[model samples]
Target: MRNLRQILLEEIPEFKAKGEAFLKGELGKMDFKKVSGGFGVYAHRDGKHFMIRLRILSGVLGKEQLVAICNLAERYAVPMIHLTTRQAIQFHKLSLDNICKVMEEGLEYNLYTRGAGGNYPRNVAMSPLAGLMKEEAFDVVPYAMAANAYFLQRINTYHLPRKLKVSFTSDKADGSQATVQDMGFVATLKDNKPYFKLYLGGGLGRNPRKGIPVDRLLPAEEALYALEAMVQFFTHEGDYEHHHKARVRYIADRMGDEAFVNCFWKYFETAKVKGGLDFSPEMPKYTKVGKTVEINHIAITSQKQEGLYSYYFHPLGGQLDYRLLRKISNLIEPMTDVHVRLSMGEGLYLVHLDGEEVQQVAEALDADNYLLGVEQTRSCIGVPICQMGILESQKALKAIVDYFKAKGNIKKSLPPIYISGCPNSCGVHQIAGIGLVGNKKKIDGVLTGIYDVYMKGKCTVGETHLGELIGEVQEDQLPGFLYDLASKIEATHQSFDQYMEANKEEVEQLLSK
Candidate 1:
């Protein structure tokens, strides 16, 4: 009954021994991929380099960890760090010769990359503001951390039919996009005791799905048990024979919801009897204090804990310079007790700061073009790097941002606009208000990159639906199109959400013209 993860872990030492030979091509690519992927090292599109994704549990990292990551980027990988949507740090443009060194260095800082890339459970995601926000139903960090610890080295969770993503949301802000995960834990309070509403079988990518509720409320303490059973069910029953239909969602779809749950309980019954999953319930440690006062009109920046403040800094296109990151880390680590939280939106959130410290941080970052309302525009690593990309999504995002700034008509609080270089939706285009998925079409008798534009997509409490494709626009025409759309919205609607709700036909008409 050994799972793929257990087998891989047992075989890692053998792969590590061949690392030098693999780098020199004395070994085969297939063998390298098998072992490297199990260790979270992925071959880049160029086939000569690699990318290593680190598992920063729940996107939480200490100052020392940040310094270690920056050091690794400088020494072995790309000069900059790439932040993923799932809140993990990716070190790209690495050589196989250096990857093992990177992995060994990570151990010194207590960071890990194993299971970060494989079908094994990826890094667990949680609301970045879980412990800091006053509006949270309950702080879900403890549960998130516990869940991560449980699955981190467990052989059963290392590999699955496909990647299983787990997220814990503090409240309906749903920053973790729990509804769209393989497993989601939405926090709730039952008679002042913490509980979670369980969601299962949700995912995005080629075949997107919103998870259905498995339990309205499961006692929070039993989360590990439920997860263990769910993992067992997927491990034993999932469609391993077909790679395309390997996700747990496929199983749920084929078996029907009632049947899926029935099958789940059979596994659950066994896991319950086996025991050892139960743990002492310790409440989340952080306390939210004081009222938040906005600084610079950026909603992500706020004052919490009386005099202390929090600031969210977005590195445009999720690229952060290693030296700058190290500088920022040094400045804050010495002065405050705050641990940095990497947001799902691909930004950094620094909490527990005094007014003077906040001012100093802001002044230091004023020159970096650190975006004020970066959530307005997002993009994926596109053409030039990503093997699957059809267009330059990051450059396109920069163009759109510049266009809006020049026009001076677009609101800072505009709905999220996502641009993906392909249908893979790494930029989360499907969940955006204005989404653009990259593709190519014949223009002037030549193939040119373009975007299939979408509108009205949402991933919120009352409304959870993917964006509907409205039209296509040439890459050169996108900035103008966005400018015109912003102007139209400014002239009529109070918000982008309101505009989308009322002007679907009008938008279609605009696109036609």
Candidate 2:
């Protein structure tokens, strides 16, 4: 694993020069993007402000790290601290000068931003509740972190056709969305020993695909061999000429699932023979005990260990209030073993807390909390923030939640929504229950913002599937359509998926309206 000291001395200083040049206009927007992304910094749509993504491996954050993040937000006067669907956190609306400073200072807290973006491996995702889930096969966070450590250093020099995504899930819950990653491992056991069920070639975004099963039982120690093999395979066979056709999913699609699996094994075998790829990684074992608290709320869940609990707090749309977090940090500062993990849906979990600590945090949320709804949705930083964005995805989500929540019909029958400003899938809308992709339509011979509506998409384990494009709705009409569709589902007393199945014609009519 690469240390903070080495990155600070070597990679970061090199990036500083490029950042300086970009600020001075010595580097063009397109030209600077080629270098800035590797450092986790990118030019905003405005080209004046920048955003930096922090590599929070496995989405886990210690108290000290949390403190530093809060401090940095205060120091930078950042209005919002954004938690991503990919389980990473970002600081947006920063000046180019401050972007570089945050990257260097953030490393002091081990919140390294290096290799957080670009055409390299992304942060290794794991179930936010991996260790705490009552039904998990075993803790999977350690192995996920191990994979993260292995990839962290290589991303500095390793070039690829496109980015690689990997994940680990403790059980079938698959909260990490393993079925939609370039690679994934689900915790399992054989003859009373730990093993991993592997999946490969899955991906989201333009031409999204569900991964195929590659191995049923792989020993825990040999997991890294698969990682090494995949890097070798993608680097060797990936298409360099076609920008959009270079992903692993495209390769798998062209070669067929069976052929892809067969070819991967050859690389895996070669990797094992190549040596120096085996190691053991262990999860943290919590040992504090307290009184059991009855779980009556959707946010509060019981951990596998008696007398311990975890609290789910979704700062509506994952745009955590900068002010609220400072207060939350103060509340947890005196607690023990209370760490936070970001959920795949852009929520967060405060785990390893005892009854008293959990209640304290719960009370804090009750006093001043972000509201939730089936429209408790998440979206990418769109428009002025994201250079690739076509619409204001964040604004769209807020309008939906604000419109629906006021109707006083927040229920599970209406599935949570996901919105992507564009088709790039940064919002992961392809796997949402109900999704919207930002688009443009010619209205009265002039361009107008619109959204492509999709329904019945899901991320269920072993049954994951992409959402189908149904129709388009003008941005202004989206909230009304969602409200009408959700009301239809509620009237029929069926879930969103069930309603879509039973009332396909009615659904289409509503979208057309």
Candidate 3:
């Protein structure tokens, strides 16, 4: 059988040479690792694009620091900053020559991009309003930080069979989508004390499934220990011969839940006897901001809370302009306890805005067409960038979105829709209520972009499954196609999920023909 890595090397010889050099540590000023997804590095290459995923511990940062990073990025890298779904900022398209300088600058601000790449645990994500939210059962930010600290610089877990994703949500907001990650922790109270309800083996790829509950409840003190044991168990027992079968889910499936739990407990007991750190250190108490500043040319909406309003700003493609970044930094400068939250759709929210100041930010943001077009749509850097991408999905997404908006009858509250650039589904399109997976189709003797429609239920790595393609629509035909779908949804009076489930056979028959 042809190895996947060999195939990749045959296609991109330059990448292979770099990979060999990378393994030998010949490439200076660059960090390299073979992650579950693929090999990645922190060094810059000529005319090659790089993105830095900066993990921020503090809720706010100094304006000067923001300005400096922006200047450095614009001078040596891409002018725009990409904010990830995980509340981290990714500085994209930087030259390899500037990696050292960028790392040095990051140190001054207490920010680093160490584990953003590679197979290592990437960013540890939590609810943006972890402690401040009224509905929060417990603050999970500390636990997320603990996980990051524990895993950082640990190379053993970095080179795994596949990429790993983890999330924590402290409230009922469901903001973290905890049920669909490799390991998810949902905050809950047990015996009137803080704890987490653990879910494991959830992931999305070619095969999508929702995670199963390995442990229902783990006290805050045991959270880290349990996680460590779980990781160790997977490392020892996970399949290594077949790359596709190497994910944690397969292990859970083969071992069975009871045996998996038993193995986990045995490892936990051993680790406890070793006397390693059990929990993260306590974080400083967050203080409330005193005064609010006005934002101009933006859209501001009131939150469920009386004093708080959510400020929305469109950073195109989730790229933050230095000027805009500086302006946002200055606007919140006066507030003693300001928090900036990154949204999954590449939008940013200043969450704790006072009622009076919402108008100012809204006015400033309104100058640009932040609300217009499908530019707001999310897509992974497909095709030329990702090794796995077979088609270009980002630009196609923009076109699809524009077509629907032009129809003028688009539903105001459609279920979540996502478009995947390729089968890898890095964009998480599979989990969306209405998903479009990219494929090539011959239209009138010409190859054109067409998508396989996946609808109903969630598209997770294991539990949630990818649906049959209901139909294929030409690039320009999306508006009409979706309009018909909307009508069908209305006629059924069922949610998109329910309608798809009830009519699966019919939908599949229509698509196949």
Candidate 4:
């Protein structure tokens, strides 16, 4: 496996010269940089890829533009476009020669990919169902947009110990899953005005930990102030010695919650006294897809007025066809209040539709080779893509999904399961009900691909607890193996977690066998 730096040096011989020019402010073109967990591009390398993450107001884009963007990605980069976990798309591999043309196209579409990577503040992620969820107490989209606007063009907040992730949720539907972010704000109404329950330090990495609550409730006006205070604190007090320990979470953890909150409040009071912040604008509307042909995936016969009939489709490894996206956009356009919700699962949901539409949508998707379900269909960045990937998880996930379907024993109801390509666990497999981490195991003195089964935790971000591996199956045995595991879960009237916990020894023995 080649490090991104090595890959760049080998593939693009001028990489070092380009980087040197960039550093000297002499580079006429931009280039890429490899970071620990991910990769980034600097000022010179702004575009020239398959997909670019643009910082647009309200985080919205026109439908035709979106189609065009997808077409560009398919033509120049990868066939898939990823709307990142950070509210941006990763826009897979792009040829070095086409970067400038892609950037030019972005300008035409009112989109540009910058500040979506590096130590800078990432795109502000908000609940996809912000105002639409039945239980939402308030909408946080406005705050999210405000934050993005303030930080996007400005370089003041760019340099930090590590990347910052901010997420806001307006309801308990767990749309954005705030608890797993570096800075999180969940909305709750108080005295008729909306207040955000603030949390800090939650992150996923080698040392995964949930964020701690810093303030119970903060008026909307004070939210950005709180953000500034937190960032300031991180800049001044954060560890710079070890890169791994330099994240905001470490500072919060080292200072302790009480002290951190007290300091944050003090800064908030100072900012308020100085009259530096105000949030008088109405909450921004949910992100909209600009005008395009209407596409409808649901019909009245399949519509449901109540009871969890909707599912957000998180594509395995964040891969989606641009053409299919256009078709989906057309399918759902006629509905008055329909919105597409992007999930942390790296998938999107077509909400407020009935079962009929879902069936239609699913059928239409079949033509594109994208399946609909929440079974063993999960993935992480894999070989030739993510530098850290050891095995091909995207391919593995597809094979697993197909295998289960072909076995004729797949359950009507599926539990959450995730497959990770490597130990880095980018897929968040640790918290999954049934998780599989790809590894090479020696069988009959020959090394072969195998998936290690993990269980025993509520693996959704923030609420995650470490899971234990209970079994392993050869790559070829995964489908039948998973079927048996699912049966065990059903037979015991237990979630995958409970069954694994109860039969820990048995599971271990089975794996050893």
Measured by lDDT, the strongest candidate is 2
Write candidate 1's Cα lDDT for 94-126 as tens digits: 777677677766766767777786578778899
lDDT of 1 at 94: 75
Lowest summed lDDT across 10 adjacent residues in model 4 is found at 299-308
Q: Model 1: residues >4 Å from true position, as ranges? A: 1-34, 155-157, 287-304, 372-375, 406-413, 443-445
Candidates' C-alpha lDDT: 0.76, 0.83, 0.61, 0.61
lDDT of 4 by residue, 184-242 (tens): 88888888987888877777656766767654688877788877776776777778778
Candidate 1 has what TM-score?
A: 0.90
Query: Model 2 Cα displacement at 189 (Å)?
Result: 2.0
TM-score-wise, the better of 1 and 2 is 2
lDDT of 3 at 56: 51
Which candidate tops TM-score?
2
lDDT for 242 in candidate 1 is 91
* lDDT of each residue in 1-513, candidate 3, tens digit only: 123223333433444456456545675323333421132233333325444566653222344555565666666645656665556676656544354356545655555555555555656666666665677787777787777666653623355655566777777655665777778888889778888877777667666656776555777887778667766766787787887888777777788867766776787787777766678558546444424444333356544445666676765445556677767777776754455765555566776677656666666665642444344556665655445565666666665566666776445334656667777665667666667777777878999877777666453222454445567766555545665666676777887667776876765554444
Q: How do all models score by TM-score?
A: 0.90, 0.96, 0.79, 0.78
Name the TM-score of candidate 3: 0.79
RMSD values, in order shown: 3.5, 1.7, 7.2, 7.3
Which sections of candidate 2 miss by over 4 Å? 1-4, 367-371
User: Where does candidate 3 stray beyond 4 Å?
Assistant: 1-47, 56-68, 153-159, 280-286, 289-306, 314-317, 366-376, 441-448, 459-471, 474-476, 487-513
Candidate 4: which stretches are off by over 4 Å?
1-61, 74-77, 155-157, 284-317, 330-339, 350-376, 412-414, 438-453, 459-480
Q: Candidate 2, residues 234-303: lDDT per residue as tens digits?
A: 9998998998999998889999999998888899999999989897876687788866876576678888
